[model samples]
Target: MHLFSRFQFRDWLLANDPALSRLRMASRVTLTILLVFLILLAIEAFILPLPTAAFGLGIVLSIEGGVAVRDKGNARQLVTRLFGCAVSLVVVAIAAGLEDQRVLSDLVFLVIILLASAGRVFGPRGFAIGMFAFTSYFMGAYFQPPLAELPEVAIGPVVSVLVGHMVRAVLLPDDWRRDLLRSLESVSGRINQILFKLAALAASGDIGEADRQELRQLEDRLKEVVLMAETFIPRPSAGVFDGASNPAAELAIRLFDAHLAAESAIVLSFQSPPPFALVHAVIGADAAELKRYEGMIEASKDQPQGETVRALLWLGEARRQLTEAINRGGACGFSGVDAAKDTAQAQAIDFSLANPLLRSALQITLASAIAMGFGLLLSRERWFWAVLASFLVFTNTNSRGDTAMKALSRSLGTVFGIAMGLVLATLISGEPDIAIPVMAICIFLAFYFLQVSYATMTFFISIVLCLVYGMTGVLTLDLLKLRIGETVIGAAAGTAVAFVVFPARTRGALDAALARWFQALRELLGAIGEGKSGFELIALSQKIDACYRDVTVAARPLGSSWSVVTRPGQIRQTLAIFLSCTYWARVLARSYEAPPADDDQRRLITADLALVDDAASRGSACFFIKRKASRTAGRHLPVSREGARVGLEMVGSALERLYPQADTLPFASGEAIARSKQG
Candidate 1:
């Protein structure tokens, strides 16, 4: 695809990176930011730079400017985000109206922060809106004059949003929907190709580890898409044809699992003419033929010596399920969320005062306020940048580690920006014509990469500021030095506040989440045994995946496993049991499934499942509350199947290993044995 080709660029822009690969955003933002610079340059052509900069700052307070909106996982559409920015701009205008009254202005400022900090209820979007409003309060107050200047004060932000909407609607095309459809189609097609290969393997009575790994990778990607995809009823295709949400990939996932399960049954049973080989012969047949195959398998289940017939019967059933799933893929009308569950989820996000949001809001607001206070006490010119540094630093930070890293990134970017800014300002010190155009490019690049990296945005914004200030006739060594010191002060204050209040020092949440994950896995094992097949298994898998993500996110801030209560490998090994058990359970649930071949086999299967279930609970208990668990001897597991015995022993051993350390036990080993005997 041509990088500059509008049609080709749309696909890249639709990617889920920080850049979102959205070319429209880049183009529209550049236009808006440059327009701001150009307009400022013309207004301040013969005047000093500081006055124009003050007004320009107020105008660019929308998120499209350097407002620093965080992208927390899933994002709304471009139009939605822009609308949110516009809403925040209204607050900016109101703040300007209240500026003459210091008490009211300060009161509104704190209220904005309080509302923004309600992350539990509003999630990231609400926080972003509130935070933008709060950031604009600084600029609005800077340009405060009297009630007469309301139009002038309101014009900057209002124009900011208006310009954005015009550029988005009139100039650039939004291709998010088209790109998502293309991606879904491509993934689903590739998955079907894999399913065909698995069908061939089944027909040939062969199974390879490499093929299984490919299915596993497919499973992982499918899960990732489910969690990351923005749920929306897509518009008509190409603005004409009918369309559906991206359920094609999800349906392909189910088909892939079904084929994999069939292969497992065939491999385990090791029977001649592996089940569903006949179905594979008619791989591309229509749904009617697949239904007939399912009926044929059902009839075979009643015959004597159906143990081997069972595997083939199950394979036939899987083939039929594949046909059904493939048909469902082409037409998705799923209610993406249940009303009751979605409401509950929204309530949780809307109201929980999670430590992350509460602490972040408190820390950043206090630090910025204090930084602004210090600047007022010193009566310094260009004091707004000081508060900006604190706000930006705290906004980017999540933990002690994140704060340290962001501060470093900020300092380095600032130094380079300042260096470049000094050179550019010196070259165009007297020529507004040259300076304005140069700053225009700086503003364009700054906002263009705003979603890409905070460091990169700050780097260009620094250059823009230097040129703007130079034009203002306020570019000075003292002011530059003051800005750097203020940033450091704010950084220090933010880290200090985090340590002192609502600190997230423990990995307790991650531990609890893991415990819940294994518990769910246990339930899934039971469900599979009961021949259950539905959305419940999918939801369970999603929960397990969510637990892993929680741990990964939690691990980032603390930067160590020191806080974890359980033996890390133990949980992981137990998870391994989870996968194998689920796979075998699924195989047993198939239509041709028999009673473990004989009575001994049945007894062994029951014993293994019981022991594994007991082990899973033990793992969960140890992981969540550090409760000791002990394994009981397995008496009924037969020696016929090497895999079954080894798997069961692994589960039993993992369960037994959950006991507390020897030092935690009061009695010696000999005394413990004596007490056991006496009991």
Candidate 2:
């Protein structure tokens, strides 16, 4: 196989986007760290006493904590940061006071771990405070600072908070609404470019495999752009659109629909290449129409005629809609749709042991304690690294399978990092000048790719640690070996705890995610049938999007050949079918216009949708009970008027096709489950 084909770099690039927000934030963090380091260096060199390691870690942690806290207003954000600083200060003082009592300090540390982990349930602000408290306690434990030195250590966090504020609010400020609009504008230009390409390809009358692959990549690119835009829509800063019909959101929705139209045209045009003459005429007409709208050129007299024109007409209409919305400042709003309300919900802290957050906290605490015991046996001073490793393993995991995968990735990353670290350490050879700049680069790369790849991030982190050791003149083969050993033990402890203590099986998680997806689909379908507003439709679609992600993550283990599931293929097939349904759901949401005018026709379509709902419920329930889904009631929706019928047909077909494959899964039939329930 060709190298490019084997790697499919084009597809991967479109899929794993280094989104603007992540890149921007990473830059800010890097600049903040460098600036802070320089200022501290000046202070420590000629002024009062300041511990370099203590101050460095404190500043990094404080900046991260402040950045992690999300609020709509700067003043509110500042207050939240100050509050977190206060909490961390108290935590530091307590930790310092308890430094002489090992047993008490250990107990206090675990309590802080449990509380901090559990605090995430309250949301971003809580998570920020939790991070600050935990990091402060860790710093206190690491430095073993006396009460007299507390004041100097406290200065680091205070300076960090102010400097981070300046960087975020003044030096590198972000306006989410402006950025979102700019992105949409960029996407619009890209879509136009793609349309131009497709038109040229249609005129060629011969689309090859390479052309098809390029089109596929372009489609994926558009999808990612839409997903990227979706991320901005949920920010608290986006409240500027509230009560004003959320022009940005409507624009995003229209752009997404236009993308779908363009994609459809490309697929259909390539499937059976259109007449070259007709393709040229259609392009001329579109260009003339655009110029006429701009008052730059007169309208064309010639009209493009052919059945193939239908495939291309939707693209033109989508373009016109997008262009009009942009030019008119989005005045052509969803007529009856009220401005979308903020969907942010406050999640009350769940203290119950059954809560996932609580369970995760317990699991991490146990893992950390176990690793702490074993890590001490390995290296007294570096024991905390193992504990930190165990905590990190459970950071974003939702299931035992997730924990297992993360642990494996961490261990593998550490192994690779050791080899690379040794080589780099030998090259640098205790030269602080070379090691310092290299360490800074590693930090930047680590944060930049933090969301892109966990293993890569871990690898860079390992390199940074090695460089740190080298700078401190403690670099050795034995120390490197100890690092890897402690990492493995920590990872092993985390994985074991996840499996043995209140374990969440991947299969169960997949089932729950599927149920949520089905529920979201049902709600969206019902809303479409009721002639609901576009705002509601967009919101519902967002819910389906979220549920789809959850399903994808939850089903990942089942897709692996090493999955412990008895019928991995069966589950994989089921998931593929679910994805198909999800695509159709998106199609229906984009295509919906209005219900049929005739009462009887409307009633019939509603009945068809009812069947769609029943199919969704039954299919989801089968997954819940580990039974095969039986055949659905029908194959398609009743054909109605052109406007809503297209959507109705797509949705009906998706749900109808879902049943048979679901029935083939390696489990008892739906009828058997029903009969057992009856008995």
Candidate 3:
């Protein structure tokens, strides 16, 4: 135990090194889960009966799961869970009211499961589909036998689940507003650090391999913080809590956009070599920039415009760097040694291993099937069980990796809870009054260990199950054994269903993500070359970010255990390249001004435009090419400087290097004509 504690402390310390931001976040989550669990247990014990408690617990779990998982939209998850529960209940009711025919009941249940499973298979869209199936299945099952007692059995669990959800929403620390603010601050700080590092590299002219690697690491960290800011949500409106109000979340959203713009600009400024001294000068100037931002944040205590203006100014500075970097190449007399390193680093970042759709589908299906199977086998009413199962199916839809850990935890938790329940029921059969306090204690223990590991969560769940079962006075060792057996059966069935039916292939998903990323890259190049507006360009950048996010989520499923089959390092490299390109495009867009009429400037623009086109095409082909022949063929796309236009000399050198091929153009002349019109 001492060793284990020390190990945990060491791991936590390592993860929280330099800054305790991540540690703080974890602490917040733990506290939030504890509060939510307590409220839920109180409701179950005092306000709701056993069946309702079951239903409500499911709802709370769903909401909690949604919040804990990154990259999932909480609002969407909530709606889907509720809808699934309702639909499953309705179906179960209809089925039960119809007849006692086992065939009809079974058919309805199967259909519901199939439909729910279909939703699970559909990825993000499955939330609603799965919900409907769940509701139908459970409601149908409940209505099947002993019609008079159906409502009594059904209402308890349904109400309980809903209450649990309510508790989660009400008690959990959303703190999105604060989180966003902090994230923005952190990102800004990091960006400043990177700028300073670049300046130092420029001034010293000692761009070693280590420095190059450090820059890449910093860039990765910058991207992560910026992404988090982009996805931050403000505190939900009062109406959202009661399912009624609309709070203006737009300002919070705009903050993200501005941050992204600024981050992109920073990335681009570092892409090619720049005058180390000039970069240093820029850093000095940015000190005032940071001060101004801090002042704006202070002033914005009572205003929104201040925040917006501060973000805009930061973005503007980033844009300024891009313009200057593009106009003035290595003027600081620094050799392009670092440029070579940058190229090598770019090569190191590969994208061939990102799988988006398959991983998402697999995760959703596995989680849903597991929950559904458990509900079906254990619930008193077949129809009701089906509905409950349906609800459980969509619980982890938005989570990555099929929530393998969560499923394992839930199954184990239930088993442990059942065992505990049996012991409690046997020891305290004559004392029903003592069960409530015991249940509360058990709930707390479960929550406390929720973060510890899967096994702990399972243990907590076992206690909860025992308390609920005991409440019904059906507390016998034999019955406890039966309940445990049923739960295990459900878990097995769910796991089987996930593996057998439309199994999600991580590799296939990665391929699809790569395709989307290539497509986005192509669009972005087209937009930039045509000198599109900032808003239009920003929208494209957002799309690119989304695609990257999808890729990240997909690759997550191939954790350490699956390393043999999935080349995560290669996939990460590919994602990095895409991210780097996107960052550059954003900078270019910000720096882009209408081309001057001078022949030199016009010529520079044309050459630069052609290079951008070539890079986009090459990237796309690289993503799609399977064989060496295809890759080689794709790499041979034409490069030209045919149009003898003025104002193009400044960019001529850069373009030649960016696109080496001297033969064919990727874009059609007609498309160029269209761009001309748009410009």
Candidate 4:
């Protein structure tokens, strides 16, 4: 005992070491399961029949199975499990009544399973199909008792599952409300950090390469955090037990918009480098003001002063603009420029009309129909085969990559599970006394390792199933083989159904994303030309981010369709040039302090203004041209750096090439020549 205690202490120390902490998380999870299993055993012995406990355990185990493996929303998981279990139970009831026609019933069950699997191939549409398939197979083949016995078989599993979910929710360290609040506060903190950094750079009158890189990384991290927060909010459709509706959701959105505004200001600052003296003075003042406001926000949390909090929030926002101006060489200075005006326009630029819900529904329906049809052709009972098919269908919901992973894992796991089951059955064949304890051990191991890997968990489940069947004196090698074959058939049918029916076209999605990208660039340029600041600029930045995400998500499915949609690559290249030009225009804007009377200063100012107008016009034209190209086959427009001197001309040329048309030309010959003289 002393040696064991010493060893345990040493292991704990190693697990807690910083380098090994990740391993500790998994270890902790394993230990938690073991504890839960022990408690479950106790409950079975004292409060319920052993079989009932097993059934409940199965439901509990299934409900928790995918949470650690995939990030399916909690609400979605709950819905899927409830529906799957309910459907399975109903099918079992029906199958029992047809016991007299065992062969016919088995064939029908197989058909139903196939159909259900096929339905799920598309997306959410086939969810029901998969559930029904699982129900039919288990009920028709294994649980061959009377209708009265059916509920008994299910009660244990359902109870076990309910307990498991309750435990999971209770064990969660932080509630959704707290998490949402933290997310908001974290975003606010990030904004403060960015502003402080910008102010420091301005005060120094030198934006080092390191500072610029740091700013870029901060902006990227802010975007990621905001997106993650959005995911944490509960969907409206999630039922009663779902995470509570966030009262602060609107505030979070506002904060996100605010951060975008700050980011835009930073970008503009970089483009239009501010005057050194004014930049230093403004940065110094803004830094002190921002610190004060941050303190107020923190104080408000404890004291609950609404007006104070609002004032602090507004101050923070004001500082964001001031920081932007300082970074841009104090071009716009502290003048109140409304930033929130362009948000609505930015949101209106969605290019793809493909709805997730619609895609999911179609995929599910198609897969189910195919699986059902195949089952019927095989002379199987429609409902039984349909149920089996349903399980396979819902395994993947329009994500081909996810579907492939699940199929591979499920197949491998099933194979290993079958072998384990066979071995277990042989071991316990004549040892009736050891059956219950052995079964209990198998259950504990399976549940504990379910999250370790799909293949391993499946193997564990197969062992449990085999053990149960053997205990009932009905386990056979032929039955084991049959089960394996059915799983393979269902998986194959589901995958094929996904590929053939209303297949999601990655190229079309990519094209739509490219169109959006051009539109975003047009808006960004237009805003800059109009001297957009505050909310408007921030919103534009957010729209750009969203468009980029859309393009990325769409590109993943492009497989062979990438070549057909040249828009993604083109738009990406165009955006880079557009961003550079916008930055330069901002620099020029900042360069305009008091009116320039000197011939050189005046010429530089005039030339920079002309370049800004030219770039904006060209970008606007390119947007329309891209839209037109998407609607109809058109020739690619070629652009040339006609009279540009300080690289602004090259930027204009790039924009022009994106949308070359006689009527769409944005710059006049005189304006181009005048700007060329200044450079």
Top candidate on lDDT is 2
Model 4, 586-639: lDDT tens digits are 222222222223343334334444444554444223322332221101211011
Which runs of model 2 end up more than 4 angstroms from their true locations?
A: 1-19, 185-221, 231-250, 266-309, 316-348, 531-539, 560-576, 595-643, 661-679
RMSD of each: 11.0, 7.7, 14.8, 14.7
Model 4 segments beyond 4 Å from truth?
1-44, 47-57, 60-88, 99-146, 181-222, 230-491, 512-533, 536-540, 559-679
Ranking by lDDT: 2, 1, 4, 3
TM-score of 1: 0.58
Per-residue lDDT tens digits for candidate 3, residues 1-679, read: 9999997665444322223344443343444444455555675688764344234434443433433323234465456556545654556566656566765655555555555544533444464545445544444354343455455445533543454344445644344544544554555466666667766765675555456556656766666666665555323322111211212233333444444545433333333333453454455665664554555456543333333333334554654553343223224321221111111121232222234334434434454445454555565442233233223432543332353444465566666667766787667766767976676666555554543454675676677666766776655676666555655555554445445555544555555665686566557545655655344555566666777667665655555242233222443434444554455444444344444233433344554555545554553233332211100011110111121121122123222323334323332232232344347
lDDT of 1: 0.49
Residue 345 CA displacement from its true place in model 3, Å: 42
- Rank ordering of all candidates by TM-score, starting from the highest: 2, 1, 3, 4
RMSD of 2: 7.7
Q: After the best TM-score superposition of candidate 3, give how far the Cα of residue 7 lies from its true spot, in angstroms.
A: 26
| lDDT (10s digit) by residue, model 2, range 101-177 | 97788779888988888887777677777877777887777777788888877777777777777777788777665
By how many angstroms RMSD does model 4 differ from the true structure? Answer: 14.7
